[model samples]
Target: MLSAVLLSVLAVAGQEPPRDCARPNGHLETVACYGERREQVEADQRVILSRINARLDQLPAEGGVNPQQAKQSLEQAQSHWAAFVAADCRAGEALFGEGAAFALDSLDCEITHYQARNRQLAAFEARYGGA
Candidate 1:
């Protein structure tokens, strides 16, 4: 199960997902599909973040507004956000209990958070003059 999820993440990062997960027929497939979608969103977020960071790099340094400091802050925020997502998923798993649906609930939690983060990164990219 863990392997499948990891594969899905790696697959989406390097290439297209093996299948369209928008409509999965069973629990196993749904998990894989959600992993794919989550990773896809994550990949998109990385691109947007990179672009924004680059733009930040080009800004001239001013008193109390250092571009390097801004970049570091973004990096720290993203790392903390990732940790929060993992912990949040664990909380969801606990709420769902140890049942057949436990894994699904956790995956759903991850997917929801991934989508939200992607939206935030995308909006930031747009605000920074779109990329």
Candidate 2:
């Protein structure tokens, strides 16, 4: 009986306690880290979207842009944003213990990235003649 009890205690002890992302210092640190990464992603998206939009604006109303070129530029920007977001989210999860704040912050970063990208595309269309 004693041996069984000892084994049970050992098993429980071997399991690590859940991490608390809400702890004062940890919570603050996590938020700051997420914020920094989010800002970077947002900035990059802004640049891409601005360029795309500028290009689009230059296009003629009668015919649409060159499907191939527009598609290629869009795909490139999207892929970059997606990868950045994914990596950021993963890092947040790892560092923040999947807390609600962490999730929301990460999502905000993604939204910002998309919005910026859209604007960038518009800017790009304006700068260069669109197909």
Candidate 3:
């Protein structure tokens, strides 16, 4: 049963596959594209995080808010957010059951979380001043 489902997913993904991710063919293809998009978002997040870190490093302890403490807080928030995203994706997979559908659902959740995080970082930069 699993093999049959896998083969079907492969067939759908391969059949007249789109040249770009904008038009994915099936659950498998969409999942692949989502994975690519997630990677790109993560890369962007890294660059943004570095800029934010640099800005944080320049700020002195004003009003009892230490620069090191601020940096640590940001790190802890990001770490916890990542764990939540992973757990959410796992929940999505379980919701969809055992198949390619499950994989696609998980990828969808991941892409959503990555995009949301990137937006959050952008907003943070806007508020705190960063590239």
lDDT of each: 0.73, 0.55, 0.74
Local accuracy of candidate 1 as per-residue lDDT tens digits, 13-91 = 6653466566676765676676666668778787878788888988888767688887898899999998998888888
Where in model 2 is the C-alpha error above 4 Å?
Answer: 1-70, 129-131
lDDT of 3 at 3: 26
Worst 10 residues of 3 by lDDT: 1-10
Better of 1 and 2 by lDDT: 1
Global Cα lDDT for candidate 3? 0.74
RMSD of 3: 5.6
Total backbone clashes of candidate 2, pairs 3 or more residues apart or in separate chains: 27
Cα error, candidate 2, residue 120 (Å):
1.4
- The pairs that clash in candidate 1 are none
TM, every model: 0.76, 0.41, 0.76
Which of candidates 2 and 3 reaches a greater lDDT? 3
